[model samples]
Target: MAIANESRQEEQNMREEHHGAGRYWLIWVLLLVLTAVTVVTGRIHIPTWGLVLALVVATTKGTLVLLYFMHLIDHRGANRLVFAVSILFVVLMLAIPLVDLGTRYRGATPPGSTVSDMQAIDIGADAMEGRFGGGLRKEGKTGEQSGSPRQ
Candidate 1:
């Protein structure tokens, strides 16, 4: 019984050592502060200032997610480099909207024009039925059947 208890305690100690508590407390506090900032930014419609503040909050969250959750903070050299490259790719992804926005004066479709044709049909179920051609039995009626014991 004593040996079993000692083994259980050792296992618990090992688990604590392996996982640790991390820096989740600080992370959580930062997350909460950022959340508050974001919410406040939305409330005050200063337009110009609000946009900047929102971007700052968003960047903070991105950094936290990348460093903490994604484990990039623990790694050095190549891993960090890749993480940076991935972040750059994300920035490039975000820049696509700005690219389109910059060209907005060139007769681009305005915002909220998601569906160009509102009158588009919704024959989704019909599409499925037509796809199968009423299953294999329909083909049997179409004069094409496999070898049938030719007497």
Candidate 2:
């Protein structure tokens, strides 16, 4: 009876090892698929939707890696809590810059102005002739500056 019980326990352990390998393989395949999806989505230009789709795919892949590859799936309590907090901090870091950029005034300077020109304008200086060396200056006129033919 003791020998039989020991054999059964050994068999159960072997079965569990096989099952674990299978689960890891599945997760690996899933990660590969998500990577393909990411590459495909990255090529097509869908404006804001492209960014959103890429983020979703990346997040899915990341979660899979964290849960399975990192062996966090069977873990609970403190481990999960730490991971959740880390994710929160990452999101916060990304979001802060995006929020600042989104709220910036788009019309801060006139279009076609260079970085130095924008800086000069911000400091309340006449950057037009200063940077261009006082050439044949004409506003909204056809030439190298305006590109469009003069009316």
Candidate 3:
């Protein structure tokens, strides 16, 4: 009888732990919408503010996942503080590298390239040539397909 009572208590605890399928479905939809917004912003390329917008969207999504999917919303205060600190560490790690990269001089060779025999090249031109379907390389700055007359 004691064993049966313990099993019943375990089942009751599990039932109380669940917030319900409705809440989960709602969160799922919100996450999807945020993902779509991120995709759109990435493609549009708003220049200076683009990276900031993307980071904001990513942080929001991460917070939602942590609070809901990870069950951190109802977790103990100590656990929440630990998670927050870990997130702060991660942000610091990423921010330091970004800051260093942004402040670096143009055309300066990156570290580890010195070990290689290869020399530096025009990164911007190469990237633009690839992205514009070879139009920039084949048709100058017009970006039109070669052998086709512009209307």
Candidate 4:
């Protein structure tokens, strides 16, 4: 059992050490070229094809970033599970805002209790008239001052 464990450890170490430098550099160059291509491709018109191509290219970029930068592909199940849950939470957050926006015209509260009803506009013909005397004033039949209620 001890000898088998040693062999397994040695094999793991060897696998970790054998990454190819030239292929890694080539991968970096490919990523850069693909990014440039995505940018340029956005400028041209392709009608129905453009949307599919854009999503495909975006997914490709996401995959590369996930595998290399996020290290998800190389990571074990727990790390990937964490990523999945995080993505799910973000989707949930986005969905809530969309629901709120969609329900704007739908009645949530009593109709007459909203903001506009709280402050009804002053219907007095005199825009400059104040109910109480600052500049323009209004008088009752007994000639008493009524304060500006229009504002």
Per-candidate Cα lDDT values, in order, are 0.65, 0.68, 0.75, 0.63
- Model 3 lDDT per residue over 10-105, tens place: 667756886779988999999999999998888896977787788878988999999888877766545688889988997898799878767666
Give me the runs in candidate 3 sitting further than 4 Å from their true place: 1-18, 105-151
Worst 10 residues of 2 by lDDT: 115-124
Q: In angstroms, give how far residue 52 of model 3 lies from its true place.
A: 2.5
Residue 103's lDDT within candidate 3 is 68
Predicted structure 2: lDDT: 0.68
RMSD in Å for candidate 1, one decimal?
15.3
Q: Estimate each model's TM-score.
A: 0.48, 0.58, 0.54, 0.41
Go through the candidates in order and give the clash count of each.
0, 0, 0, 5
Prediction 1 global C-alpha lDDT: 0.65
Residue 2 of candidate 1: its Cα lDDT?
67
Cα lDDT tens digits, model 4, 1-151, are 8657765766686578655577557767878988887888888877655756776677677767777655455555455788788767766775687567546653443344442224445546554464343455566576666554443
Cα error, residue 111 of model 1, in Å, equals 9.9
Question: What is the overall TM-score of model 4 with all chains considered together?
Answer: 0.41
Residue-level lDDT of model 2, residues 67-116, one tens digit each, is: 88887765555668899998898788878976775565656545444312
* Residue pairs with clashing backbones, model 1: none
Reference-based TM-score, model 3: 0.54
